[model samples]
Target: MTQDSGVGRICQKPVSALLFDMDNTLFDLVGAQIASCQEIVRFLGYKDGEELFSYFLKPVHGFESHENIRQYMEERSIPIDGMYEKACRIYETEKLRHISPYPGVAETLKYLHDRGYPMCIVTDAHSRDATLRLEKIGLLPFFSGMVAYDMVNVKKPAPEPFLAALEMMRAPAGDALLIGDSIRRDIEPCARLGIRTVYARYGDRFAAGHQDSGADFIIDGMDELPEILDKFNKI
Candidate 1:
């Protein structure tokens, strides 16, 4: 069912609980990561920040960008002992400064919370990393439950993290909605378990695959979310 408002249209379903992807969905994750990487390279006295950032992510892609700094320094024969450790420290310190929630995210979350809809965060990020980001964004209180990659031996696409969140919230798969950017990681896996899927189209970074097959709904921004939930009377 589609409901058209001034802002956008929400394809509604019976949504009981919300399972959210932390990065990109809630905030500009790519922006924060790129900023941190660029600052790290500059701190290490290198002008080729963007090129090196690409190289660093090419092999071991994810949030663990600092781990590759050591290999990069060694490959270039930069002879900067302890530079890798120092770079990691710098990246960690600066990353928090660069992080914040996307516009409308905080208000939407508060609206959902006040209306008594259970919300859980299911992310393929280290617990420490996820915790820090939530704290920075002031969103820690809105989530009723969280499932982090590090908390489980398996990550997303495995269904373990999603299942964990469902269990934590005591939510049935059919009554829940999983929203995220990745088809491989979030949409497809949750769809396998019969949960409704909402593709956070604003957060799609790679643009490699289509969301058509898995997602039951698609939202371009957080502002569209409340209207979607409105069908469920969350307003």
Candidate 2:
């Protein structure tokens, strides 16, 4: 169950499975998220839309959870009944409208799928939302399964979601490689479980480099994955 057809070698340990982070890994989630936030800000008629979005969506200190958003709005005395749900609805709609897979993602996934590599999506997103984006990008069919945030009632970096995905795929940690953009969420957890990791540099929304990230390999783009795997397979 190895493939080396003019690509590089497969991993020496035999990579039977791949776990991918959905946002900012397989697709340009940053762009989609920005669009979604813009729609919400517009709907709310914020005069300083960008500043407001940045204040709320800043990478480190910004709010991510619905509860956080609600709390922020409440503290600010923003009077919009059911504003959270409305924002969510608008964001989801706008995100879908702008959703797109990163360059070469579809081809790479198809190649791996054709080579019989089982793939699973492990995301901090809700199942329905993840599924919608995956389906929109045409990458859903290639995945053997998915582990959403709600599934394990925890996010990445906790290892529960990663483990849940592996369990569902019946793939051992050593036999799996996780490709993701976030070191904190994807790489750290997988590495703790003895799963190999490939840091997706291209999808790094935070623009963090490989300085302290313990990734097994670093790839600039998804197109380089097959070759990297081939080289690893031969090692």
Candidate 3:
């Protein structure tokens, strides 16, 4: 499922550094969150996990806020004090328990790392959650630094987080490659910054259908990245 834009050779400047989106790009964070929602609902004797999951999608409370759980409970007239704390704990614990990197992620990362490509993470997650997830999956050591939502106080689709990552890695936009799942947040923003982007199509869960991603390259899996990098280097 790899597709290239076929506009031109990618080596206008050779890629010297890598930037990655930490959530679905590296692992299925949404899937883990869904599973966590299911666990929470089951523990509370609720019938529909999807109903609980819908609360996180609401814009009132941020996606990661535990306040969503409270709101969900209140709507059902469920007790809030002890139950809210317990629900939050179950959600956090189960989410982390279910997280694992996509296949070949570690190998691809090691391949890139061994070849001297400095990497940084740009994520919408808070710093603590990002650190915990990466550490849980044992990929924390691979990144030189991270620009988290808490650090930049901005999320992707904004240029600030991407700029902060490039600065942290000391890599010019043209000389760095960013791999991420969301076209709107990851691809378009990086393209505007003159950074080459690899849209992780395999990780995308939000796009409605098969919309064109507007990325320089698209990879179906992490293992395909080395080949893309090879093309960049050879050109």
The per-model lDDT (C-alpha) reads: 0.78, 0.77, 0.90
Q: Candidate 3's residue-wise lDDT over 65-91, tens digit each? A: 899999999999998879899999999
Q: Where is model 1 more than 4 Å wrong at Cα? A: 1-13, 59-62, 208-213, 233-235
lDDT of 1 by residue, 109-189 (tens): 998898888999999788888889999989999998889987887977898899899899888887888888787788889
For model 2, how does the per-residue alpha-carbon lDDT over 142-199 read when each residue is reduced to its tens digit? 9989999878988778979988988998989889989998888887778889888888
Question: By TM-score, is 2 or 3 better?
Answer: 3
Q: Which of candidates 1 and 2 is the stronger one according to TM-score?
A: 1
- Give the C-alpha lDDT of model 3: 0.90
TM-score between model 2 and native: 0.84
Candidate maximizing TM-score: 3
- Residue clash pairs of candidate 3: none
Full ranking by TM-score = 3, 1, 2
Q: Name the 10 consecutive residues with the lowest summed lDDT in model 3.
A: 5-14
lDDT of 1: 0.78
Which residue ranges in model 2 land beyond 4 Å of their true spot? 1-11, 55-64, 67-78, 82-85, 232-235
